[model samples]
Target: MRKGFLLAVALVAFLFPSGAGAAEKVWSNSVPDSVWSDGANWVPAGVPASVDHVVIGRSKTIVGITNAAFAGGLLLSPDVSLDIRAGHNLTLGSGDAAVNIELEGNAEIRTVGASALAFDAVNRLNLNVPSSARLKLGKMSAPAAVHQSGGIVQLTGTVTAAAGGTDWHVNGGLLYVKKNDAFSGNMTVKVAAGKEVQFEKGADAGASFDFSAGSSITSLDVADATSAVPALKLKALTGDVILKLINVPATLAPGDVLRVIDCDSPIPAAAQVRLDPASAAKYEIQLSGDRRSVMIGTRAVASADVVVFTPPTDTLASREYEPGVPFAASFDVTSSAGQALTVTTIPGSSLPVWLGYVVTPKGGASSDVTVTLSGTPDATVSGDIPLGFRASTATASADMTYTIVKKGSGGAPGPNPNPRPGQPGPLPRPNPGDPLLPDPNRKSRSGGGGCDAGLAGIVALLALLPLRSRRRK
Candidate 1:
C-alpha cells in the first residue's frame, strides 16, 4: 500500500508540477502597459490566481485589483496606488509579512490575518470608508490628516494623533459613538503634550463638529467649526494651550460647556486672560467661575465675565456737561481679584480728543476718573460717545459714555443731576407762587410781595377818587 501511494504522488507531480506550488506575479514592464488583472501583463506570463503571491509594481497611474481574496501575501509600493474595487476584499501582511501602504481611493483595504496596522511617513492618506468598508490602524505615530471624505473608521485598536501639527477632518459618519466611552478620535486623541491638532469641517454640509467626554488634545484649533452643542469638552489636561474658539456657542444645551477643564497644559499662569470681545461675541464665548472651560457659560450669566461683550452705557449717568465748561465724571471700578488693579484707557476707544480726561488714583476700587470737556469740541459732536478702559489685574473693562455737549446749551448750573436722593433743593425766594423758579432777590425797600401790596393800595385810592369826583359834581 505504501508503494502504491508513492507511485500515485509521483504520477500527480508528473501531471501538474507547477500547480503544486504557487507562482509569484510581477506587473508588466513593456510599453503600452496593460491592466493589473490582464493575463499577458504579468512577468510569469499570466495574471495571479487567488493562491499566488502578488507585488504591485510602479505604474503611470493607479492599478485596480478585482479579486475576492488572496491566499498569499501582497507587497504594495509607496510610489504606486493599488485600488481594491468595491465588493472585493484584499489582504496584506500574512505569516509575518508586511508592506508600507498609504491608503487612498474610495475602496476598502484591510488585513486578513494581521490584527494591527501602523501608518507612517507624514501620511496624507485621503481614505474614504463607505458603510461596506472599515479601517484598522495600529498604535503608531499620527498622520497629518485622517480625512473622512466619506465612510467608517473602525477602530480595531487605539490610534494616536501623536505628532505635532496633526489634523483630523470629519465630513460624515459616526466615529464609534456608544455613550461616555472615551477613546482616541472618538472624544479624545492620545497625543503628546503641546502637539497641535485641528478639528475642521469638510465637504459634508450641515455637519457639526462633536468632541466626546474626557477629550484630550494639545494645542487645539477649532477656529473653523460651528457646533450644535459644546463642540469640544476636552480637559486642559493636555496642557495650558492657547486655543481659538471661533464659531463656538456661549453655552451648550442650557448649561453644558465647550471646554470642560483646564489642567495639565503648558500654558503659564497669567494675571488676567484678556478676551477679544469682538471675536468672542461672534462665537458666543464666555467663561464662568465654576466651569474652567474656555467657551462655557455659568448658571448665573452675570457671574461670568461678559463685560467685554456688553455695549457701552451712559458713563456720565444723568450728568450733562457743556463744551469749554469744565465738568468731571467719576467711575467707581471694582476688581474680581483683590490684587492692586491698574487702569488704563484702551487705544482706538472713544478717548477724549477735544475733552481732556484724567483717571485719578490709578489703582483700587472706588477710583474715579475726571473727564472734563475743557477744549473746543468739534461743532458736529453733540451726542454720547463710549470710552473704554480696562483693569489690568482684574481682567475687567468698562464702557462708559461721554456726552460732548454743544457750547452753552446746559442750563445755568442747576442742582447736581446726580445729587443724593434726599438732598435739599436751593433756597427759595419768598413768594406766593412756586418756590422754585423764583425771581432773584433785589435790594429794595421791601424784600418781595411789596410791589403787589403797594399796587393794591394805589388801585383802591384811585377807585375812591372816582367816587369823590362824582359827589362834588
Candidate 2:
C-alpha cells in the first residue's frame, strides 16, 4: 500500500510540474530590440501573462511596452527604466488581491502620448517611488496608496479616485501637477529637513495645480532658505494655499526678509494665501510692488502702539430707545502698548443729526479714555441709527460701531425703511368686523351662542311641541 501511494504521488508531480503556478519573469534583453511583447527579451522564454511578476534589474536599457500588457506586479531595480509607448496600456495585478510597483535606486518609468497604467483589483495599488526614482506618466487609475521619499512624480493627466482608497504621502519629493490636471485625492506634503517642494507652472502657459476638484494639501512647510527664486511659482492660483514657515534660524534679526511665493500673473481675487498665525505675529508679510512675490520681514517691530476700542454689550442695536428721549451709553478705549490714544468719530460714520459723542478728555489723548454717547434721538429718526468711533495712535487704529434703535410711537419697534426681499413686513391690524378674522366678541360653539346653540334651541322647541305630525304619518 505504501509503494502504491508513493508511485501515485510521483506521477501527479511529474504531470503537474512546479512551474504550473504563478512565476517571476526577469528582463533578460536577449533580443536586439527592447519590446516588452517579444518573448526573447524576458527570461523563461515567454511573454509575462497576467499571473506573472515582472522585474527589470540593473539595466540602463529602456524597455518599451508597444502593446497592451498584464502583470501581477512589477519592480524596477536601481537605474532600470521602462516606458509605455504611445497608445499602449499596461494593466497590473489580477483578481481581488493587492499588487505593488516599487521604483527604487533611481529607476524611472516614463509614459508617452496617451499611454496609461492601470491597476485592476479591488485591493489597493501600492506604489513606492523612493530613492530618487522618477515617474512621468500621462495618467494612472487605481485605488492607490502612493509613498514618495526623495523622488519626483510628474503627472500630466488626472488620477481618478477609487473606492478602495487613494492618498499620497510626499515625505521628501516633488509631486508636480501639470496643465491643470486634477488629483482627486488628499495629498500631504511633509518634506524632510533641508528639502523643499515647489509648485511651478509647466510648459503650458496656463498650467497650474488644479485643487478645485475638492482635493487639498494639508499645509506647505517653507524653509527659510535664501533661494532668490520663489519656492512656489505659478501663473495663477485657483484655490487657497496655506503656508507655515519652518527651520527659521534663531539668529534671524528683526527686518530680515524671506521670499516665499511668486506669481507671474495677477492672483485671482477669490484665491487666498493663509499664513500661520504664529508666523504672521513674528513676521511682516506682504506682497511685492508688482504683486509677483511674497516677502516676510522677520520679527518686525511695530512703529507705534495700536488702540483697542471696547464697545458696550448692546452694540448690535438690540435695545430699543424712546424717540425724543435723552439716551446715554459709554464705551472704554485703551492702547495696546500703553501709548496715548486719540479718540474721534470716523469721517463718514458720524452720528445722526440729533446724536453726539464726547470724549472724557478735551484733547482725547490718554492711555485709558471713555467716550460718552449722549443725545436725544430726533422724533423723526424712529429707526436704527449707526454711530462709529475710532481710536488711533500714530501707527495703528481701531474702530467700533454703536447702533441706536429708536422705538416708534406706542412703544412699538420702528419699521425698517428698506426691508430686504423675502422679508416679512409688519402684520396687518385687521378691523374688528373683518370676515376673514375671528370675531373677538363671538363665543365658542362648545360654550353656546354659535351655530350649536341655535340648533339646540330648535331641537328643544320640537321636543316640547310633541311629534304629532310624525306619529300621524
Candidate 3:
C-alpha cells in the first residue's frame, strides 16, 4: 500500500512541477487603448500580475499604467520603449523575489508626473541602461545596483538608495543630476576616459548634491573643457572624495580657468579633494576664499617671473663686521607685473642660534618683499656658518645660500689716547730745569745719579756748605 501511494504522489508532482504556472506575457496591443490594466492588451488574455514576466517586444508600443501594478520582471527588446504614465506607478518584483530589467539596443524607460517604477528593499533590481538608451525619472528608490555602460540617466528628482548601499557605474555615459535634486547613496562612480558625471545647479544658490545623510562618493570624473565643466555642490563632505580630470582638450591654453566644484558649506579641514598628479602638474589648484569651491587655473597664471634683487653669494658678510657689532643683510625679491611674492627660510636651513631674521610683508599678494637677516655676534662666534632661504612667486621660485662670518674679537683693546675726566691720565712729564729729577721721556744714562747717589751727593753738598761758612767767618 505504501509503494502504491508513493508512485501516485511522484506522478502527480512530475506533472505539476514548481513554477509551472509562471508565464512570459508579451505585449500584443490587441485592445483599442494602451492601458496596462486592460486584460486584452497582453497575450494569454489577461493583465500581467505577480506571476508574469512582462516583455515589451513591440518596437514602438506605449503601455500606460493607470494604477499600481506588479510584475515579476520587465524586459524591453531592442528599439522598444516603456512609459509609466503620469499619476500611475508600476512595481517590479512580488513579495521578496528579485527582479531583473534589461534594456537592450537603444531602448528607454521614461516616467512622468508622480509615476515611478518601485522596488522593495528586499528585492534586487538589475537595471541596464546601455548604448544610446535613456532613463529619465522624477524619483527612484534604488534598492540594488544600477549599471549604465553608454547611455544617459537624468534625474530631476530625488533618488535614494537603501541602507545596503548602491554602486553606480557610468562606464561611457553621462549621468546628470539636475539642480536641487538629492541623490543619496554609497555610490562609487567609475567613468570612462571620455565620459562625464555632472551635478548642476539652476542658479548656484542652493545645494546641488546632498550627501548629509551619510551618502558618499568615492570617485568622480570631470572633463577639462572650456565650457560645461563638471561642478558639484554639497552641504558638507562627510567622507573622502576624489576629483579626476578626463578628456583634456588639445586647445587648452595658459591662464584658462576651469571651475570644477561649488559648495554652500565649508569643507571640513580634514577633508581633502585630491587631484591626480598628472593633472596637478598642468594646472594650479586652489580653494576660494570662502573654502566652498575648487578652482583650477592653468600653470601660466601662477608662473610669474620672479626677480631677485640681491646678488647671489655664498657669504653673508655683505659688509665688514666687528666681533661685537650688529650685522644686517637684506634680500629683495619681486615678481614680473608686480605679482604677489613670498619669501621664506628653507626648511632645515634655519639661522644659527646667535642670529635672527624677519621677512617684511610676511605673506600676501604683494609685488615685492624683503627678507632681512640681522644678528650681533660676540667674541665667541667666528668662522663661516651656513644659511639658506627661498623666494617664490605664484609661478616662479629661487633658492639662495648666504653664510655668516665672524672675524676674531676685534684685535686686542687699544689704549684710549683721549682719556675721560674720571679715567687715569698718562704719566707726568719731568721739568727740564730740575737736575735732580731724571726725565722719563728721555732714556736714562748708564751711570746717571741713582736714588742712593743723589742722596749722598745732597749730604756732601750740605757738609761743604758748612765748611765754606766757617772759612768765610
- lDDT (C-alpha) at residue 233 in model 2: 50
**RMSD to the native, candidate 1?**
16.9
Rank list by lDDT: 2, 3, 1
Question: Candidate 1: where is the Cα deviation over 4 Å?
Answer: 1-26, 29-59, 69-79, 95-99, 102-188, 202-242, 246-278, 281-284, 287-473
Candidate 1 clash pair list: 129-151, 239-264, 239-265, 240-265, 240-266, 240-267, 315-401
Taking the tens digit of each residue's C-alpha lDDT, what string does model 1 give over 324-349? 45554554444443434455656777
Per-residue CA lDDT of model 3 for 1-473, tens digit only, reads 64753454344335323244666676777332387888877766898887567776665666777877777777676666577888777777666655666666777777787777777643456556675677676667776555555566777666666677655555546676663545665543434444555554331212232222222333333453233443554544433333454433434476667666666576655445656677667766667787777766766544537556464342323633556788887666666666666777779988777678876763566667777877787887765666777777666676765545444312212122213369764455566546677554343334665563477678878888878888988
Q: Return the TM-score for candidate 2, rounded to 2 decimals.
A: 0.41
After aligning candidate 1 to the native by TM-score, how far in Å is the CA of 258 from where it should be?
8.3
State residue 357's C-alpha deviation in candidate 3, in Å. Answer: 48
Candidate 1: worst-modelled 10 consecutive residues by lDDT: 201-210
- The candidates, ranked best first by TM-score, are 3, 2, 1
Distance from true location, Cα of 358 in model 3, Å: 47
Say which prediction, candidate 1 or candidate 3, comes out ahead on TM-score.
3
Candidate 2 lDDT by residue in tens digits, 1-473: 64753454344334323233666777777332388999887767899987677777634767889999988777777767788988998888777656667676788777778888887763655556784687776777755555555567767765655554455545555666553434444322233333333433322222233333222332333453343644455445444333344444344466566666666665544334555666666666667776667666675456657566655453323345677678777777777676767888779986777767777742444467878877776556675666667787767777765556554322222223223479776555455445587544243556645674477679888886667776777
